[model samples]
Target: MILYTPLAETDIFPVSEADLQKRHCVSHNGKQLYVEEMEDGQFQLLQVLSTDPNDFMNTDYIPGTILR
Candidate 1:
């Protein structure tokens, strides 16, 4: 099947509501982050939700970094 829309894939086929509920926002080292709770009692970084361009320069903020 072909998709022809300017919208992002996630916008076309959105994640489940339950999955969205599992995700949350947090602040670490003065940076705002979007993370998801893992089954192992740790949080996995989803996205760096910061407006500061400098925050994206840090490798630690890369998506999928596990947090305690």
Candidate 2:
């Protein structure tokens, strides 16, 4: 099992326009999340995680990382 911890405040650390164009997500938890690109040229985060019953805001998801 993997765990992710995300930011608490959107005011300080926000996803920039450039990052929105470059988020290539890897599959997780036997399911793949699909994030779409909006007509305004910004990538929308997958609501799948945000709508989780435990964490409704999905603010606590940071992909696991391997440190070697």
Candidate 3:
């Protein structure tokens, strides 16, 4: 799985396991990280660390960030 800094936009790109040959951009070390798949299969971005789900209820706006 890959990781990325979440955007504030409502339209989110969906990463699936069937599209492993795709490319994506992530932010790491104050730079934009580009990742490409080597295999022709599906993929998904799994968050290694995330905010508590309950925190969503208390905030009017949530800023998404990469955990690692």
Candidate 4:
């Protein structure tokens, strides 16, 4: 799984499987963030800010890499 620190002015890191299971991270704005790797090697960001979870759920998965 890939891990990104959007607030950090550095490149993103590819998380090790062991670290992904053990490490916890918080965002710069103090929100708790969790990363999970999908079976397809894509990563997901959890606990994101959104006005509607249902709308988000209805939307198609946009394919793109996160830039650091």
**Which candidate number maximizes lDDT?**
1
Candidate 4: Cα lDDT at 56:
44
The TM-score of predicted model 3 comes to: 0.22
Question: Candidate 3's residue-wise lDDT over 20-39, tens digit each?
Answer: 44556654434333444334
TM-score of candidate 2 on Cα atoms, chains taken together? 0.27
lDDT of 1 by residue, 1-68 (tens): 89899997569889998888889999888888989998887999989987888888888988889988
User: Best to worst by TM-score, what's the order?
Assistant: 1, 2, 4, 3
**Residue-by-residue lDDT tens digits, candidate 4, 1-68:** 56655653223446567755743344423433444445565456543444655534633322232212
lDDT tens digits by residue: candidate 2, 1-68? 54445754335468888756655443445334445455565444454443446544344333332211
The local lDDT score (0 to 100) that residue 35 gets in candidate 1 is 91
Q: What overall lDDT goes with each candidate model?
A: 0.87, 0.46, 0.40, 0.43
**Model 1 alpha-carbon drift over 4 Å, by segment:** 1-9
What shift in Å separates residue 15 of candidate 2 from its native position after superposition? 2.3
Q: Model 4: clashing residue pairs?
A: none
Name the candidate that leads on TM-score: 1
* Candidate 3: segments with Cα more than 4 A from true spot: 1-21, 39-68
Looking at model 3, residue 32 earns an lDDT score of 38
Residue 63 of model 1 has an lDDT of: 84
